[model samples]
Target: MSALERLNGTRLTGTEEAFALHRRINRTATDYPRDSSVPALFAASAARHPDALAVVQDGRAYTYARLDRLSNGLARRMLAQGFTPGSTAGVCLTRSPELIVALLAVLKCGGVYVPFDAGWPDERLRGLLARADCRWVLTDRPEQLARRLGACRVLPVDEGVEECETAPGVEVGGDALAYVNFTSGSTGSPKGVAIRHRSIARLVLGARFARLEADSRLLQLAPVTFDAATFEIWGALLNGGTCVLYPEGLVRLSRLGRVIDDHRVTVVFLTTALFNAVIDEAPGALDGTETVLMGGELHSIPHVAAALRRYGPGRLVHVYGPTEATTFATYHRIDRLIPDSGLLPIGTPIQNTRLYVTDGTTLCEPGRTGEICLAGDGLSPGYLGMPELTAERFVDREIDGVGERLYRTGDHGTLLPDGSLVFQGREDDQVKINGFRIELGEVAHHLDRHPAVRRSHVTVSTERGERSLVAFVVADPSVTSASLRHHLRTLLPAYLVPARIHLCEALPLTATGKVDGRALLAAHDTHTPPPAAPAAQPVATRD
Candidate 1:
């Protein structure tokens, strides 16, 4: 039998039970509109709820009508400046209402939006702009960005600009490119994942994980640069819900709990690291939130079990996806009644998405381990400007006599007898630190580029329920951790920097002359445990 046939059968589980579960898995993949786009859908909501509060931040609010006018005005200005359907624009601004305006404006102008983190080092920011071929930037501090990025036009985004009461006359379809998000790449440079309008529209239309509705209120906690922000921003606007922006600074647990109660936010997404810490540092921190979505690495089942005991698993959702899949591909509403030992299922595919577990050539049956590949509407077109790399990762294969294109996720997993996927670790040198994906090869490449560095091998160390990056380096006598970190900051983003730099006379080598990372990790200088508390604060930055 074919893999799909085996997957559709009930051989492992009861016949009736397996078929019933299969129907439930594919239930959400129905009734999605093919022609709707993000901007178009949001506009419809705006017309229906013109007077409703669309966004709130720092004691300020913007109604749907007002936000529409602001974005329309900016879109008109962009069109006047010759921005066209295929043009790409960069938006560098702090987290504020202006950020939302810029996003909608770019989409309304029929241009692709590329978000920039103002907190990033200028060199790294410039590298992104150059790599994306973005010649226009929208920012409040136009003078600073203009002088820094020579030969680029910087337009100021502020309330003082002219207001436009009418919509911009441009045609945007679901097939057009919407945004490009940069993620850690194996080549030491960040790669931009190009996503389309239909991908996001499909995610928001019948999304059950977040349960966004006309009256739902969500906290916009994700940074604009991350793909998760796509769900926070558009998920609310398109659903006619209110989006409350979280303030900047490291998020204190005590304060976050208060904000949830104060704002009456129904839905929120926290990184798995933060969720685990909150379960320890301050129990019941998320009690006020109706639905909590956790992503970026798997959760500790014990912590999840405790939360389920206190609250319920129906309120906790495990959302799984990579940037290449446009935010989320699969979701599971954890079963609260189950025991918290061992691994939990990743659940089934979300709307318009399909999961296939394969062993290179054929799909693996239940109870067997294989590489997890994704196929469906949410898949990104490919990485930007790297055709060869894109071709290597995304490929077409024949399954059940049908030609289907699949993205090789590089992560391994197994299909349980009951049909849910149990996530295994990555097949490559990639790790998720506090929900941020880091490529060890990228980190090592940057470290080895340093003048004093001879060779570097980076590995992950988990101690006391925490994961951290540890770099083992053989360097010159004058090389220091501070110096290497300083050089790395100029080249790589802050999240990619290693937490520990071990200076060794020589890295352990195997008989085959290859660096044995396992031996190096076993002999690392530190055996002491890090603090039981989380390393970074969970604060949500506005920009």
Candidate 2:
């Protein structure tokens, strides 16, 4: 029998045993200040470097002392208004220095901040805030949003609030809920992942993956709602670095390059899709950036090689983790060209983090494919208001006679003998488009709600190295793909909206009577041409 087959049945050799141990748990026992909250850490940094640049945007800059006083004023105001520890507040504002102030203020007041993208539809934002049990919303357009969300009180942070610049007296612990990040769910509802202050500290403080120091200038390009902001924002503030906010709205590649050049940005994190675009369109954008980290989807080998060739090795990093793991868990620095496998290793776990590859009950041996599981200080407590699901996903498993709780990432990967992990793809219908996590079931659930539609299936289609959502629907004869697309755009976010909707008489099925997604795509490829527009109509047939 092979070494892998005998791994579970008998004792292994020393090298095999070492590989087994490595596959079961790859971790670094790094210590961090576990008793302090995120706000407390920021406060400490402010005290140490009072005059250091803390945040900047379009020629506007705030020193550490100034930002601290601003947040202190807001926090004092919030406390006087009955906001207390454990209170949930929604922050809906455009990307600016004010948004950072609001986030820090909420944490200072010991409230959980639920970030809402201002670009999101009002209806969608209202539903999410209600689901999160938010009693107040801090926004730039408070009056307008307050009218729509009548149930929650709204406070304006953009125009600035006049209050005392004294810090609040409240003391928050490390285990306190810091923020709630919502991700796409299969049940047609977005689930909020509740992360704690300690989790954030574990990710940013003493992070070995990227360079973060007082002299570091990190670019804040990600949306506040995305968990990546946790790294970009706190990774700077908590480290006495400067967070240069990118201008709001669509990220133009030319403008992005200019911003990085002007700010002398030392660290940057980009989604795989955007990174690929930068490499293809503007390779010079990263010329000045000291460290460029990219992930959120499987990377292209050619793009990786191109970036390495331009930036040289040791500067470009490939990171992997889910929102549930606080931002990043494993990071691989590409010091050389990728091997013939063309698959980039996700690398090993970061400091104070643990990673495992397992097949439900037992840990997988090296070279065996299994689910990627994560544990350690970076793991979030659980999903907000999803006890059952929290229990299902986060479970206690005995590893090497030690009971530990691990988040079972549905992503499939294989553990290498050297303890690095290589991405193989996900085991579920979720897909990451432009770095946004999307659930195919959630899209289909909303599509099936359309009155004219009988049934629908949503799948991702890749053409020319780009991934887009495609919906196949069996609908009324009078219904056009345009109307269906419009209907979906109203309910879902822009990214969740399918790029192409194909109207059909029936959906293709497998012999076992399930929706044959492969058959549908195969037939569509045979019958339909490349989609030039946002919608398509094809005469689909059952297999």
Candidate 3:
């Protein structure tokens, strides 16, 4: 009989017994502050270390006291403009000291911060703002874009605000919404994930994955809009450490190496794609850093081995998590790389987090593949204003007589006997291209909308471990791939646009009349032109 059976009068089968054992093996119970906000935590850090360096960018360093004062002054100005607690503010700014200040100021004013990539197309950015129901936008550059947002107030933080030097007295709770992160949605829009202050607090404060100590200098290299920024920014600020911001524009390898050395940076995080590029191009870029984390897509084994050989296994850590689960949920510190180790495990749960491999009903036995389910303090409340989707993805379930809410990640993986997880693949059409989550369905939806195109199907093609989007479209004879590419560029970001578009008389379909993805790839592989010489692609820029 299983533990569940022992607790009640129900009989248990062999599978049920295995499920009970698997739960015991995977569950990690840890304590974290359940009632703390980001501002409250940052204030506590500032009060303790007033003279410590808080942020560094563009040859300027801001101390804890100075940063506190700067954000406080801006927060008061926002409050004067009627920005209230629980209200959302759109932040469209490049990665800079001003961007960090604007984010902190919004939290200080008790408003939810919604970040947008400043480089995104105007139409794409506007659509995100409308979806989040934004009424105010804070920007450091291109005030024209902010002004174009009708009925939305614009605040430019770089222009200097009133120097009140006093923090706002607004009270915010742990459960209060903090920020909204937009991810690729299958319905041709983006899904804004409404995260709470507690969720972020759980990620940075007392995290075991990375060394986030007062002496730790974290390199803020990821874009402000990326979820990795949550770990980079707050991991330093809330921990009495210093955040060293990389300059704007593409991330050149030589510049990154210089930044790490000059700032004495101790911690850094890179997407899998960027990490691979760094290893292949500039293997010594991260040699001075103590901890280097890589994630956001399936990591390449060769790159991992190369990194371990250069930096040693102790300094490299592999992390995994979705936007809904704050920044990172699990971290696998590479102790040593065994030859022919097919793939590295994502490792165990981080502080105050739980990971479960389930087959939609009960936990799977060790070594069995199932959907990766996450639960705990790191989990977000749900999608913003999307209760139906929230219900479908984030569900409540009972195990061992305890009810808990779990976020079904839709990522398939298998739990090893030692409790680490090995990622299999996604269960849906969603793919992570260069650390950006994208839905192939979303791409197809936009492609089919072209007036000259009748129907379309989008698929990902992986060559030499690098993945790019490929589209097959049934369109007019006169419509060329270049024209379709131009059309997508206007509607979507450069990353979302297919690298290659093929014109077809009709898309291959299955017996059920659905687009046959495997068949399309097969046909493309059979008649595809010879590969051209690979060109150097930008590694650091999201585009």
Worst 10 residues of 3 by lDDT: 529-538
- The reply for model 1, stretches above 4 Å from the true place, is 1-28, 337-341, 511-513, 527-543
Collision count for each candidate, in order: 3, 0, 0
What order do you get sorting by lDDT, best first? Answer: 2, 3, 1
Residue pair clashes in candidate 3 = none
The C-alpha TM-scores of every prediction are 0.91, 0.92, 0.92
Q: Which prediction has the highest lDDT against the true structure?
A: 2
Residue-wise C-alpha lDDT for candidate 1, range 320-398, written one tens digit per residue: 8988988998887876534444876677788888777777675676676778888888899999889999998897775
Would you give me the overall lDDT of model 3? 0.83
Instruction: Give the least accurate 10-residue stretch of model 2, judged by summed lDDT.
Output: 534-543
Models sorted by TM-score, best on top: 2, 3, 1
Candidate 2 lDDT tens digits, 189-279: 8889989999999999998899899999999988887889999999999999999998745677778888999999999999888888889
Q: Against the correct fold, how does model 2 do in TM-score? A: 0.92
**lDDT, candidate 3, residue 2?**
47
Q: At residue 32, what lDDT does model 2 achieve?
A: 88
